[model samples]
Target: MNTQFIKASLFAAGLLLVSTSFAQNKNDLKNWPSGYAPLEVGKRIAAHFIATPHTNFGRPTPPKVITYPESCTWYGALKFAGASRDKELLGQLAKRFEPFFGPEAKLIPVPDHVDYSVFGSVPLQLYIQTKEQKYLDLGKGIADKQWGPPEGPRVVAASHEFYKQGLTWQTRLWIDDMFMITALQNQAYLATGEIKYIDRAAKEMVVYLDSLQKPNGLFYHAPTAPFYWGRGNGWMAAGMAELLGSLPKNHPERARIMKGYQMMMASLLKHQAEDGMWRQLVDDAESWKESSSTGMFTYAMITGVKKGWLDAKTYGPAARKAWIALVGYIDGNDEVKDVCEGTNKNTSRQFYLDRKRLTGDLHGQAPILWSAAALLQ
Candidate 1:
């Protein structure tokens, strides 16, 4: 045999082996049943999002401003559309934003609070999917203002204090702020390929993890509020997953964030109910099973397993079970039911327990889309 023929055969065999390994990794969830498949679930949720009007946390009235939950849902829909190669759905999702730039310009959130700043993630995802200059300018502008010097007539003292500390002027040390802040900055990094955005996000995450994460890896609603609220911890879980999903492996803060993420995931795994849902207060078995937090945690786990940040054998089954259980909460109207109402950091456990359970809340809708999109990826 010619020496060159032997070399070519070896090269081809190596290429085939690598390609097969990649396929196996990507298709880890390939055994999913037809109705529960990620593609099917993702498309259904995307359609629901496109058809729904702007909501004020599941209330009937139209929102005066675009809320972070809506922004999150929009971002998730865009991701699902892009991943599933649904050009029509992508165009429809894009059209929904046209009003924001035109007649409804007033609805674009002012990035003075973490909740408002998170709206940037939607347009950044839009720009990433479509490469639209207008989207980039709009999204990047919002992300920049979060860390910009305090300005405008509404600036607060906290803004100045946080800014001086090299944190976002909007920082409040709330657990949910982790997701709100990181989502915008991480998306900005993905869209612009700028290290500054990701670095800011990673550094900020370190601060939140150090300050908020407890010995058990869960977080209290706030320093003064000692209750382990489900959605609050869910926000942190999802935030860490989102950040680690993109942060470079060699980045200085990656290991710390990864450690925080792994610790939290293990705790969540222990607290998961027999039905695969987590409660309004994750550590409290007596608290009602909540959809939004459950959805968020499921999304985080799905992302972790898909990214190899989690062990597939352990987290994969948990994530799959959670997704199926979560979807069961979707009502015939395509709205997720049993989502805890909008909550505040309160020391009283009853406050969280008594919060109204809502249907069709974008808070719940967003994470279902995120989990579905992640699984498809």
Candidate 2:
């Protein structure tokens, strides 16, 4: 054979080898055991969310930034961290938000421009869990400013309008908003004996559920957005689970909340990938597989089974399968791998899947922590 022909053959073989290696790695990941070490995995991922900082409140600043939408997640991880015999790490995470508070222990920048409800509520929940007055005061300050007078109906800003055109908006209630604000409201009501907070949570939840529910039972992530992002839905599902756990069984809205739960759970089950995970675009498979969303869904489903909201015989197997898929995405050291990094102003299916995954991002770690916590329960 001529020298040129031999060289071409060698190059083709090298390409084939590279492809084969990648295929093998994918298979190895797929074959990983479904059962995960909850305590160990939760700690590792929670550490990542706490360690990465943006501003004084454990929020990342630009050009690398963390949004208020993710605040509940960090707080949730902190809650789990404190509960799981990891006081040292929990204390450290709590301290990160200390700088954001005032001398009276109230959170500064009250009624924040971004998702203020969730941002403030998280610290409050942490305070309640840890008996830290600072978290409580900060949370109360936010609640006072955003929810208005303690005696009247609480009004949430639909968006921050600019120049009368409603430019640079942030006020509209979305499905994910329920997760961000209501849980804290419930905690506040329980702690303070303030009926207003509970009333506020109920009203806003009704608005979100009524306005955002699609004809098919799945709630859209945002009011104006047409596409459904799995993580967004996961946020709503997780919110429902948390709210159900906190709300009294006799509350009038309990049935409505349960109905919403049934709707979302049914829709999510239909969208589960063959490998036991969900894609970034929930109903669309051409999009990339997403671990964060899958983790969130698995977290909600597993928690539901524990709470009797779901029949474990039917959902448990699927949850276990998703958990297995989730572990396959993690690396050998228990860190979350291939998590899609923070997104900005997203509105479409392609926009979500097109996001690049960065290892150890808090967005990924928070859900991973929840996933592990669910398994432990």
Candidate 3:
């Protein structure tokens, strides 16, 4: 053989092998996800998130910033760290929430809204685990804010007669508030040994369940909107699961709350794609595979198993399957992919169907972390 041609052929063969190995590493996730630990993958993703911020967040994208949605990811980190009893991870995760509440760590008011109060979950989780007075105080502040008088709906027209008459909180109702605010209330109850917070949380949940939950067992993104945006519904389920995980068994509202949660979980079980993920619209067949909602549903179900609220024989495999699929979305670089961008409730199905799915969006991180924590049990 000619020397030059042989060398060229050898180089070409080497290139082919390199390409083959790269492709295999990529595809191996779908086929061999059981080898990956959800906790490790979750930790890596959370670490990468705080280190490098990525977004097409619509408005100005600040360098290395964290926002409300990403709070969920950190909440999951808190859960994972607390579950593992890893003091280092707990301390690390707890500090990540400081900015949201301001330097003094007081619950910086978000004008007349309850949305920003969701960040309380982080401090509350830290307080619950560490028994640190600072976290407890901050978390209590937020819970009291959420626990206080009705601000009414931020969308003026959204304050329907039903909400005005039925809800107890001073804040306007948003579907996201379910997970955003409720968990903090439960935490406040735990933090202060105050039955009032838990009682208020139960009333708040019923108010939402009455007005927002459609017969389909999923929530409308808002009062006037009938769309079941995946993450919003996921928030409802995850929040309820969070509440149930901590609420006293004989608490007056436990039966009603569990009924709603079970109804929603049954619907979630029905809608889950065979691939172990839920869609962006949740009910819409045309929507994309949404990682955040999938994470939330898995958290809800796995929590049920851990709390003895769900049947392990049934939900355990489902959660593990969901975890496998969820971890697959995290790339070798630790970027979480296919996370739906920030969305508002809209009247049309196309609105949800068209939402952007971005890589490393913080909203995708929490559910995976929480799932890992729950599964570790």
Off by over 4 Å in 3: 1-34, 53-60, 63-66, 95-111, 149-171
For each candidate, give its TM-score against the true structure: 0.91, 0.76, 0.81
Better of 1 and 2 by TM-score: 1
Expressed as tens digits, the lDDT of each residue in 142-206 for candidate 1 is 99988899887667887788789888888788999999999999999999999999999998999
The number of the candidate with the highest TM-score is: 1
Q: On residues 1-377, what C-alpha lDDT tens digit does candidate 2 reach at each position?
A: 89999999999999999998755543221233434556766776676666665533222444222356357567667667755867787777777766655442343333544354567766776776688776777677666555543222323343423213322233365666666667667767755777777766665666677778776667677766777876677777777777777767887887888888778888888889889988877888797788878888888887887778888767776777777788778776556666666554456667777877666555566676776666665
Residue 60, candidate 1: C-alpha displacement in angstroms: 3.0
**Comparison by TM-score, 1 against 3, better one:** 1
C-alpha lDDT values of all predictions: 0.89, 0.67, 0.74
* Candidate 2 steric clashes: 9
**Model 3: which residue pairs collide?**
73-366, 149-170, 150-170, 151-170, 151-171, 152-172
Using lDDT as the yardstick, the better of models 1 and 2 is 1
Indicate the worst ten consecutive residues by lDDT in candidate 2.
160-169
lDDT of 3 by residue, 176-286 (tens): 888876876777787788888888788888878987887878988997778889998988999999898878999989998999998898788788888888999888887
| Models sorted by TM-score, best on top | 1, 3, 2
Which model scores highest in lDDT?
1
Better of 2 and 3 by TM-score: 3
